[model samples]
Target chain A: DTAVSQTPKYLVTQMGNDKSIKCEQNLGHDTMYWYKQDSKKFLKIMFSYNNKELIINETVPNRFSPKSPDKAHLNLHINSLELGDSAVYFCASSQDTDGGTEAFFGQGTRLTVV
Target chain B: SQELEQSPQSLIVQEGKNLTINCTSSKTLYGLYWYKQKYGEGLIFLMMLQKGGEEKSHEKITAKLDEKKQQSSLHITASQPSHAGIYLCGADSSNAGKSTFGDGTTLTVKP
Candidate 1:
């Protein structure tokens, strides 16, 4: 079984359009995270949810919002996407909030805003 | 906040050759992880090191954490074209499962 999976593996939208990426993990983890990898290949944390509760929220734009319906699903919604929003988005899950535990990542979703 | 810096932004090695990639952190690390990412794909966890001076090996890849827990190195022996990918190092200083990742080191293995 795929441990973690993200839908719409590839997204190409025009500027000002809104889109959402869905992530689901069957690892039965409590902590989940959303990360953005820019063109430079710099992976930056965007948000984290533990058991459906927001734990970490980076300085991302207001247009970007993360909704965790439950511990197994975390979705990212971006409004009025800009060119800068073109990047690969990854969803990850861990057993707990302990850094000692290894994280399982999904096959990232590549977003392109033109 | 913590920052990870990786040296030799890119590397190219011939098949069967050996190479090493280094990751340095700004603060002491509580957990260090090594991951590999093929183009347009997610990261695959390779190994994790916690204790200072800790070392772990998987197949031909070995990773080590420095005594100070502020740096780590990943060495690959007998490289193969299949081993080519982007290697990333992530550091966790807060033990919160939130990792700070380095830019990444792109490796290209030639036959």
Candidate 2:
């Protein structure tokens, strides 16, 4: 069984459009995160939610929003998408352990904004 | 602190060779995680180290964390064509709540 999964593996949209990507994790994890991988392949954390509560919010723009209705689901929505927003978005979950932790990643969602 | 700095941004090796990738940090690494990713696919977690002077291995890959907690290394033995992909090192500093990630080391193993 897939532990983590993302929807709309690929998305093509125009500027000023709004779109949403859904993610779910079945690992029974307490924390979930959203990361953006740019053309340079740098994985940067955007937001994180734990137990249905927002725990970490990186230096992302206000147009980008993350929502988690339950512990197992976290979704990302972009408003007025821009070309620079074209990149792969990944969803991950982790079980915290001894001042450290490891994340389980989902197959990324490649967003292409024109 | 930039957190984790992975070296050699990319690597190319012929099959059956041994390779090593380095990850240095500004803050002491409370936790170190290694992951491998194929193009356009989700990353697969390779291993994790929380305590200093720890060593873990899976199959032909082994990872080590120094006692200083500021450095870690991933080594691949007898590399194979299937080992081609991007390798990333993630660190959890004492700050917690989030993990800092490296840009990644792209490995290209040619047969």
| Highest lDDT against the true fold, candidate | 1
Question: A1-114 in candidate 2: lDDT tens per residue?
Answer: 999999989999999999999999999999999999989888888998889998889889999999999999999999999999999999999865334767899999999998
Go through the candidates in order and give each one's DockQ.
Answer: 0.83, 0.71
Give me candidate 2's interface root-mean-square deviation: 1.9
User: Model 2: clashing residue pairs?
Assistant: none
In terms of docking quality, how is candidate 1 classified?
A: high
Task: Give a tens-digit lDDT track for model 1, residues A6-110.
Answer: 999999999999999999999899999999998989999999999999999999999999999999999999999999999999999999888788999999999
lDDT of 1 by residue, B1-111 (tens): 439999879999999999999999879998999999999788999999999999999999999999999999999999999999999999888647678899999999999
RMSD of each: 1.0, 1.2
Alpha-carbon lDDT, every model: 0.94, 0.91
Q: In candidate 2, which residue ranges exceed 4 Å CA deviation?
A: A97-99
- Best candidate, DockQ-wise? 1
DockQ computed for model 2 against the true two-chain complex using alpha carbons: 0.71
Q: Against the true structure, what is each candidate's TM-score? A: 0.98, 0.97
